[model samples]
Target: MTRAPAPGHGGMASTRTHSAEKKRNSVTKAPTRLWGGRFEGGPSDALARLSVSVQFDWRLAPYDLMGSRAHARVLNRAGLLTDDELERMIGALDDLEAACRSGEFRPAVADEDVHTALERGLLERLGALGGKLRAGRSRNDQVATDLRLYLRDHARQIVSRLVELETALIAQAEHNLGVAAPGMTHLQHAQPVLFSHQLLAHVQPLTRDIDRLRDWDKRAAISPLGSGALAGSSLPLDPQATAAELGFDAAAPNSMDAVADRDFVAEFLFAAALIGVHLSRLGEEVCLWASQEFRWIEMDDTYATGSSIMPQKKNPDVAELARGKAGRLIGHLVGLLTTLKGLPLTYNRDLQEDKEGAFDAVETLLLVLPAMSGLIATMRVNTERLETSAPDGFALATDLAELLVRRGVAFRDAHEVVGHLVVWCQVNDKDFDDLTDDELAKVSPHLTPDVREVLNVQGALASRKAYGGTAPDRVREQIAALRAQVNDHASWAADSEA
Candidate 1:
């Protein structure tokens, strides 16, 4: 074999030489495979087609390059490369990163995955010296490291977007404070509540979702970079150093677990799925409220869609999509869990199945969150309609029962009394407000004229003044508390990006 040129003398000159050679032999020269030095021949065409991952995983190139930079530092500390070689290697990686970002460099047809493609880029720049960077690490650990970094970065982004949605909710609540609406149990009006309280209910789940992402980051912060192919490297590599350089809390403690563990991905999928479920519920409400039967809201023209055929239609498409995509997100979570269930310890080819679901889920949420936020921020609430219909379905019957309880009637007796009054009103075609004192006296002895005190929607709303209740003051307190939470989450997300 012809001897390759040495490193220092041909650094930049080698790049130009390799670039020209790459063009001249673009079709004819066989791409280098990361493994199979001992094999007599290349993989079969079918095997190559089935094994390829460069398409979806190429998005991981930035994180992969980040790992490579930190790995280079560890290799230099291990004395695997001279200081000058490390410097040259870091420079080459930076150049390659710029190329990747600008789309000048990309995976070719034969490149199996991101690692192979990036390695090719490095080799093109530094010639044989580029091959030295792979020492003391395997694709197993490298990929695990890349994924953790990718998720950590995205978790912060998701939190930031979540806060934006929360902020929209807070604004709507503040604007509509003290507006009373029918609160339901089992979709039947049970009581009257501040409309702000209903809007704030959606914020609670999103806050927990943000908390879950923050909590998930704690477990995901440990790096797996130095675990070489499910076994520790024989070389004197410093994994803790690599972990710190890459912003991981520490190195993974077990070699086999480092390469094999995908619990982080599963947990992320769960968080994402739960977010979808919560949004689905919110979407269901939007659909109902915008319907002619409810007429509780009117969606903005920008957010609502016009029907192709029906001139009168202004469809809640954003809310419908939110409800529809929830199932897709749920399927991604279940699919990943099923994929992970029977996986044996250490890395397997099945682990390759992890990235696409995660990538798609993240992309889905990133797309959905901003749209949902805009939908909420821009839509108009029909406060008059909500307030007028607040007590239409005997919504204050419970308040009437409780009012009798305060007047020394046993709750059971009061409940029976209110039941009779509701039946009497339905039969007589008269609401409680329309009942005369003589009519009230005939229904029950406890149905004195003063019973009308609890019959109106505003009185029913004001009666529930306990903490976390639907009273106006309580709902204001709840809104303040949520605003504080949104601020704290916003700060945490900002710090994480920093």
Candidate 2:
């Protein structure tokens, strides 16, 4: 791939303006060549199109301008720029930002990337003073710094969306207290579990995703501004000053690694991929539960969609989209990692591939999260159907086995007894409740009238009151714990911005 012109070389116009009138006219003059005294002529049309990244990267204009402001301050501190020059440069940058925000400033066909476009804008505003701002900076370190700041801000936004989805889960769990459903393993009914317990299972992984974002932020906080074009800058620059001004924890220790490292990007994509997987799991369940065969829940009209031809059809489009989008999220992660896998120990054109994937992953999640939270919040569980089906498919067979174990039978013997009872019920088309005491005795010598006590679904549910169990009490306790954790994370996210 064709690489755009790197920064911090001999690009800007020479600072030799003797006449004040000529300098004033320079501000409105056509932009000077970004690469001066090098090539004989312009690049090929194909090369320019292939190298331009300002179209997609224009979103980084604000962040690039922010880093430039910090860089200007550092340059002034190092006495490389006079106070008046620094003041004019900052004022021009402020004007550029306002124009960018108002859509009045944008990349032209000649602007190769965000850095170049912003440079052109600054020159248009302040002439030679704008040229001075490029002294101690390079697009290599500038792009790196801008990306970190952008990801830091957007990661917090993604976390807040996750918290909203988590809060919706906890609320649903609390509201569905005491409701029972058939828990499945391998897509077959296994046991009776409180509906709340299943909801909390989804919340557990998302809480870890939130923690991953926090951990990723810590590593991404180091600034790379002074690592000019893969080596330390020649100027008497204060990297720490710029780091502090940009809200970074510190400067990166190595110039080569500082410009080349993309671990933070990969880590963020991994977090997003996992979240997509989690949401896909929820989507699959919602799709199953909302179907005619299950009828365990109903999607609200706001989230569900009608078939184009079939007027009676109400499809769970949001859940299906969530499930489908998971593959896209995984694709983004894999593509980015593949791009980073073979690069050398410095900045390269291939690194430009990183931003689009990460951007897609972030944008995908930001859109999916609120839709998911709304889907869960507006969904109505069919409590009567859930409660009625909780005991079907021999779901209480485990309870029968445990009851026999309590009556002094060995566990192996109890398991055998329940296995035989299940086979009998399956062949005869009769449930466990259909059997009388004599019929039960005929199946096992350990049978007794009190065995009926554990045969009911509620008895089976209450019997497992162990911590983290699906019992109503245990599920309620889990709901409370999750709520506290979510609230704590929300507070931490707020303080991160502060």
Candidate 3:
């Protein structure tokens, strides 16, 4: 049996040696680093191999291909590449992309990074003409440019998935309409609320996460391609031309800031962390709602797992995993922040550390967001259990006071009367509804047959007909408004593309 090759070194040729071989065979017989003129000799084989990023960055093929085309046109416009050379490079880039997409482009293990692999591919495809495309650009600028494009694309996909998750939550809320549940504060039941209201609370934060991604794209719109190698290029290049071709609103103003800025990366992490927080909030509720004591929700067998030791146990593995993954999302943010913090201006080896953090965050959220949506969509709400738990906390005791006010009892006095009656029921092992008229009258001779009016939980919930209340009428109105907001958010995302 053949042994697998070790990481960092595949067989005898180091990652750097492979890079040099690629450069050696490349259109430039000199095998030049885009910025190697300042150096006396090529990087050490071990150092080159150690610094390689082609493995993960191959994911940037599309962005690299697109950006190369954009840069080629920009160079042609600047009178540097000539129109014929530009056409050749563009055609070669397209063919190279097709090769990558079709799995025919064999990546070199020593190919320093994605920028290097891309240049190597272009050279192999276009012969000597590919050399002209890199006349003024460095991998420093190229990598940064590719990353921005990749993130912009990834953010759109994740936010769309997030919107889908929000839609599922909204649908669940609608399906469980009028299902009464106890709303809690400090883990103790505080009031009666529609179960939909609680689910909608989780939806609102995730929706904000989608909005955050859409907003951050605006900041990422500037292209960094022309900020070659930290200092502005001396080639008299037109940054705006490339920026326009690439769909950037403008060229980044400062060269050093352009290569050094992983702020866009950090912003994506910021957005991902917020999504993590929202998922954690939803996960916590899922865990609680699925508990034996609560028993307000049931996880589908497909989404849940049975305990190994306990034969009858059905656990919410999906929510538990989501809650667990939320920690990883936070760790990605902190790791990226710490990695980028205190780094010097312009490009550094440390910026290479940026990819894993963001890539992990995006990968985790992409999986968890969609899985959570499916879990919520398929799970059943135990409406009877929700209603049964609703009346335990004397959730309608406040309604009794509201009833007194309608009867012309001063609110302050009515509040005292309800408080006394609640204590009376508690001391006697009775629910607020279990108290008889004689018992209610003992607390208040003013309490009439109308005291029976406050005993019904449905009547109590219905009386709360104020705007945004959990009353059936109010909930329906809220549903309409929430649906409208979802449509408005969708429209805003569409307008951004316009």
Candidate 4:
């Protein structure tokens, strides 16, 4: 029964502390390497167990392999590697990467992160030749480079999915252009609006989200591979050549800045959080519109579910999941921000906590955006329900004031008169159009029965003839603009990877 050390035991302790422990789980190594040369003994097994990130960071192997291959090519061309040695090193790296991707390679428990795991794999695969690949880099720069590569690729994917979601939104809007619904303020009817106009409002913000992700990609394009530790490597390596080969737009100019700038990570998650808010807003509407009380839209069977106990229940599980997903996306952003708030220096083990958050945000957006898009595209808008509800409340009251303003009445006097009329209608258990002509004229003798002409929901929506209004023409104009924006994005998305 050997007891655990108090707080700071400093020997090469046993590795049995971790429950799922395996021999290959820690960053196993040659003890006398450059990083460990100053130390007499190794990290205690307890420390190793706590410090290892191989369990999750092994996801980075492919990126690690790519950076290592690029570095090896640069070193050999700079006359560092012998011709035969370079060939053996490059061949082994390529093979190791292929094995990792093909699932034949397994990272051992002794490996700490993907960088260490890959190096271990390389050393075993090519013996002495593999040792030469680490000549001009550190895990600091290497891990940062790998993360940048991973982010660029993932951001591009998220942007494309956002575009797809925008397209679905536009499709739904166009399909329901003539549809009218009660636009609400604080969840109560405020005005009659084209259903398509409501849909367009949702589309534009998500479109901005796509642009935000694209903007993030441009910033994330700098390469971090030459910034070894917190200083530039002394090796006469061409950072540009490696950047170009690896598809980075430029080499990171400063070593410390390269490793310290986790801003991109936080930026991405923040953008994801904004997009998640958009999805949540969209989901809230879907959940509401699909409700038996509103019935503005019906969820198609594929995107809805049933209640086991209630035989007639058709639950909107998809939208509910979108609502739930938004919380995760937002949590990811907050989690990463908290992780980065007070960190010091070029790299710390604290930085390793960064991966789980980013991985979750990316995965959530990729999944949530598409599912939400499909839900929108397949939904059925019950136009009659919307129209009936749109007119039931005095939703056209604003249209009445606009009509009065158009009729040579002072706008201030018209607002007063309109408010009185609404209160009258509400008290009498009637609607705006249900008012008698004499009642309106009592408030303002200049008013006539013709005022009721502006009181219907369609009249209310159609009367908003300003640019970007809920008028049918404005809705069509917006649909055209949305379509154009989506087409441009589609083309850019198609050519992005190329």
**Scored by Cα lDDT, where does model 4 land?**
0.79
Better of 1 and 4 by lDDT: 1
What is candidate 1's TM-score against the reference?
Answer: 0.95
Task: Report the C-alpha lDDT of model 2 over 35-133, residue by residue, as the tens digit.
Answer: 655887777889888987876787777788888988999899889889998899889998888877655555655678888888888988887788888
Off by over 4 Å in 1: 1-28
Model 1: pairs clashing at backbone N, Cα or C within 3 Å: none
By descending TM-score, how would the candidates be arranged? Answer: 1, 2, 4, 3
Q: For residues 116-182, what per-residue lDDT tens digits would candidate 4 score against the true structure?
A: 6677778777877777888778888888887787777767677788888898888888888888888
**Per lDDT, what order, best first?**
1, 2, 4, 3
Candidate with the larger TM-score of 2 and 4: 2
Candidate 3 residue spans exceeding 4 A from truth:
1-33, 404-415, 445-448, 488-498
lDDT of each: 0.88, 0.85, 0.79, 0.79
C-alpha lDDT (0 to 100) for residue 206 of candidate 1: 99
Worst 10 residues of 4 by lDDT: 1-10
- Of 1 and 2, the candidate ranking higher by TM-score: 1
lDDT of the structure predicted as candidate 1: 0.88
Question: How many residue pairs collide in each prediction?
Answer: 0, 0, 1, 13
Per-residue lDDT tens digits of candidate 1, residues 1-498?
011111121011223446755763673277768997999999999999999988788878888888898889889988998999999999999999887766557677678888998898899899899999999999999999888888888888888899999999889999999899999899998889888999999999999999999999999999999999999899999999989888889999999999999999999999999999988999999999999999999998989999889999999988999898899889988998999899888899999999988988888898889989999999899999999999987889999999988989999999999999899999989887788999999989888888888888888888899989998888888988998999999998888787
